[model samples]
Target: MRLDPQKTEFDLGYLGKQSQISVYWNLSSPQLIEQSIINKEANLSPTGALLVSTGEFTGRSPNDKYIVNYQEPSDQEIDWGKVNQPFLPEKFDQLLVKVLSHLESKNIYVQDVLVGSNPQHQRRVRLLTEYAWSALFARDLLIPGIDMYADGPDFTIIQAPTFCADPQIDGTLTKTFIVIDFVKRIVLIGNTQYAGEIKKAVFTIMNRLLPGENVLPMHCSANIGMQGDTALFFGLSGTGKTTLSSDPDRFLIGDDEHGWAQDGVFNFEGGCYAKTINLKKDLEPIIWDASQSFGSVLENVTFDEDTRLLDFTDSSVTENTRAAYALDNVARRVKSGMGGHPDHIFFLSADAFGVLPPIASLSPNQAAYYFLSGYTAKLAGTERGLGCEPQATFSACFGAPFMPLNPVKYANMLREKIFDHHSSVWLVNTGWTGGPYGIGSRIKLPYTRAIISAAIKGILEEAPSEYEPFFGLKIPGIIPGVPSKMLNPVKNWESPDKYAEMAEKLKAKFRKNIDQYKGEIDSELLTLL
Candidate 1:
């Protein structure tokens, strides 16, 4: 196998010195795009974004993910259950050998990047992928310009999309597998072309490791106002974390993952991996324009074959369509990718049940309660096996699949940070209102934007608020540019009695879900449920 003459001076001996793999190290976005097209792995949109299909798997397969249980202190700390499933260390080693053997005689792409923007807490990562576009995805989503690591990467991801695991022999649930060994500081992903697994695997490692260093790793988007006030938006996929945080008025700190240090909050990524299903130029001009720019990677998005024109509204392939582009593509992004401690935090929930208020203020304990609850509808296409209808689900910390440690650990850290920084927390519902899913219309984007803008400007703090007894949330009576009637969710429904019934049902769900954390959390906080 021939190696690229421009390959960095880093050693590939750890992967196997005997393997004759052609390594293409640290290729630029344009070069990667060229390779992608040449390899028939992707096509270019009219505007130059690389368009590729993720094949059968368009979303993450949570059940297929695992963490090796052999690690000493780290393995014992992992929340060992379905989300943080345990895999045999020997099995992992066997699978890694097989995956590396599969890559032999094939071209591989390597990218050395940093996970955190702040140098003090940044994690060095070395990503190896079988596809050029996959390497580009990593480069686009991670901090680049790391020529070499002095002591090797803090974590190394080996993604072999074409290499499938044998469930019976490999100990994986399926042919697709994502196995991370914390002790080894290595991640192995097989039989999944879904690029999200690559990004999320890195996040999972950070979630597991950051708490030890006293840095709170978060699954949220952050942006700063003109006055330099930072705001955080937290939610699972399809709940508007990306859309809400990409405010035209504010400079985007990061779109997805972040780390809150004692000094400030820093982005975990150098780019935004935004959901593009039904994206419109007028509503989300920044993301829309970025999605169409050169060097961007559009995954699972449909386009006109002959014309090479992208149709953002097309969801025939999947509603989980995504665009991965560097932060430079966004004009209103923070160049440093860091922000002061967040002054306000928004917990975004697409309440398909339509019982929750559009926006509500939370006390400290209530913040912890709701943070642990992390309620949202499992939107269609966000995960595999979900139908078109939305299903209500609770993901602790809004990212249960990625969080390896216990939910209580992150909750406690968040509460401590809030107390130290005096940050205000608000619950924002970007989901349906007036009624549940099909019967009700989604809360308008402009109205939600208005609510957030008012909150950022401190308009809601002084506004008259009414007690929402069901969940004990403080609902503002009015928000600037938003209809007063829309503030209270029950009033928007046709039948108050039906609304009451639904509210009671949802309240019961919150209680049932939080029951797991009964002894773990403050008992007084449970009363808020």
Candidate 2:
């Protein structure tokens, strides 16, 4: 409500500008709703409707009203290269009195407040809050209007909620922001948090507000568990990242997002940001309970006091229906059980394209090749669960959207990690068998889970998984549950023409990406493809 808070500014000129996409959102704040109405320059779409408290996003949701609010070109708006400079609450030292003068009455219960940022955007406030600071009425805040430009000079104005926090209070800053001016490669977005089961797990995620680290942090699902010592799982929004990771037999480390550290991998938050859409009690019971907690923030679920129930399928929260809750929501929580160098890095390809196999083991080079060549197709509205129409897309990583590092750099890391850790990674196609994506049904979640579980267990490397020499691994047994013919795309499909055409198109796309990496990758890795 007030803009006069004296704010401490961070000079994040590390990554440069125009390289990253920045976000200024609160974990849970009414101010976000307020900004939509107040800031005309802040480019906001009613996308928050996906995060609204009302039924605007519920079933039968009308066509999107997400009109871009800010009129500035993205180039001038987001500076991916600048680091997130988080100073002491000194942020408001200059504007405090002015800001304080503006607020009529925010919370009389509040007294003191402070601010911080993560230069690398690798740290999280909520997860470490218990280990650090002391405050009253402390909550995440956002200012959409000012976010259109840089935070340092032009407008150091930060729209933070006034929290009565004590700097001298027992804890140090819960979140610390720093710059990683190292190599710009090895950065991939979305996967930073959601890729689980057997991933290059990075838990201590979400650093500074806009620290340009040449990397991107995104939201999705992930799973990884050691079988003979290895973890791996992959699923898109509806595929089953949650179902597979909830395996009772595994020593469940934190699920969802994590960060990489010199000491291995650490979970970013104490929780998981799970989708509650059409959430089935039989499948996602854990997320259901986690969504109701005080600290838990609901994205776009319809909340009704009279019913005391959340209609998760309601798009009002987000078509995603997410719940950001501590991973502790599960009884068997692993504070830091993962991050051992991956012995098997699996990249899941939910190919609505329907041209790939049910599962294909790969050599580190092949793995790297595919990882950088993220290939998949979306089923007709399966992404939004409507008849919206299917489409195809490819990225260096399953999550190219949030990657702060370069594709080659990340591929190099995967190569190095695979070799150093001797990991066995794979590219599993959970797409179609009988036909290409649109006409065929997606592989059943249960069957997909069985295959993934088997893959983690080395079952794929056992008997039936015929060895593919170039791939550096074996394709094993059909693990009783799934239809035997479905295991191989060639067998499951009645026609190979469609599969061939799709494969050719993908290969051409892969070839087009070749020149981009010709100079970055090693000769041998390049030769593998």
Candidate 3:
């Protein structure tokens, strides 16, 4: 298949088709790599492969390999269960059935909740809760929504499909959740809800998978509709994933979570979950204003019902206090809510230790590490908040919770997509500067947002004379319009001694955490610290 280095031919190209998936492992031909192993005192046919996207080509070779050779399953056909224990618990089926009934019975409660709520909040939660439950039942009922693969690994994925735009409703979910039991060589699609629409999407797409052209399931937020190709920003929650990507210059696609189809990137959450702690007007002025309205969900916040004054610093509700608002809340949102191929990708991380540079160019390995690390600091809001103090938190790929179970598995998929799709990846720190965590304030959201804008526009590609190497990125000739002193974390400390103390303190924390997972990581990768 002809590949565009720049994500330009979106909506109308081989990549846009449903058969084109981001594979996680390399493939020999149309069939996946498999092997046999002994388990439970019996020999079984274990899968030695993971899934990946097949790039445009007549035959598979270098450009289209992502499936990883790992342990295969003993089952003859696709049984998602044979892979491992279900993420659910004993009798989870019964428990879930009860919850579904409760939701239906309390449907009136949801409607009542809507009475005092802004229409935006109502719609956002409705979609999230609906999809969550739909996938749950769809999986149980063996419906089209939670189907499995046709030819590779056995697992389920969250997929939203496209349908003829509904003239009545603003937007609607076309494709539901789907499971691809590649081991069975079958794609089980979920279709309980939106049957007419979902069928329109899956059937139209599935029949088109060519020998090498494919669509590997991916879990990342992506958007298109900017000036040219849609630019994608990949990072975990606190890495400014939402803050940095809401560019005013381009049409805003979805935020938070997305399902990447061969055609374009679509959002999972119909809304945004922005950090509300220490939120101010200058940075995210629009989102900032969204805090007090009827639509937002104030997490651990204190407010006056009569006066309408809000203390953004307060966290009385819950640590995960968030402002959940629909993407359409901002007028600049795209209608289809998906973007074309991306031209750039910026991975955000909040490095509290201040040991690494502010920015760095990522080698594919470093990109995988950082992405797996999902680097960021815990903040005042969010369930894991440890107060406003920033601290280094490295998750396997990008601090995403679902990592490690399939760290190498997911990384291979994402890496292949970026490269074959010709997407660029950059590592950026949004944590501390002069002092780590408590000693320093977060890299201002407004300033960080500006830097990201500059970077995405290709301004930082040339590597300038007056650039500072933070980690991998060259902080370009100090981003104008922001305080120059703030750009250099080293100088921002209250005093030299304070800076030294913070660095040592954070270093100790890093060592403690790294040691816990020492066995799993190779010393070579660990030596970078």
| Highest lDDT model number | 1
Instruction: Give candidate 1 misplaced runs (Cα > 4 Å).
Output: 1-12, 16-20
lDDT of 2 by residue, 1-529 (tens): 5752222222223223222222232222334333323432112222222122312222211111011112244323322321222222322232333323322222111111111122233322211011000011123111112231232221111112232323244111221111111122111111011112101112112321222433323222334454435354433444445555666555454454433333344343345545577777665566556555544445455655454455666543345555545454566545443445444555666676565666777776677777777666543322224544546666555544334445565556555556765767767776666766557777776676677677777676664766432233355546657777775665566676665566666566666765567877777766554
Off by over 4 Å in 2: 1-230, 234-243, 260-262, 292-295, 303-305, 314-318, 337-339, 377-387, 466-474, 523-529
C-alpha local distance difference test of each model: 0.90, 0.42, 0.41
Q: Give one digit per residue, the lDDT tens place, for model 3 in 1-529.
A: 6322211111101111232222111111111111101101111111211111111111101111111212344222111222211222222222223323333322111000110011221111111122222222121111121112223122222222221222123111222222222232222222222211111122212212211133322324455544656766666555676666666666666555443446645543445556666676776766675444332333334555455466666644533434545454667767555565566767766777664445555666566556656656655333221455544566555533322134544555566777767776777777767666555566666677667666676766763524333233334446545566665555676786666666566555545545544555556545444
Please count the clashing residue pairs in each candidate, in the order shown.
0, 87, 85
Worst 10 residues of 3 by lDDT: 107-116
Better of 1 and 3 by lDDT: 1
What TM-score do all the candidates reach, one by one? 0.97, 0.60, 0.57
Cα deviation at 432, candidate 1, in Å, is 1.0
Q: Name the runs in model 3 displaced over 4 angstroms.
A: 1-90, 94-226, 289-301, 307-313, 384-388, 403-405, 463-477, 482-529
TM-score, candidate number 2: 0.60
Clashing pairs in 1: none
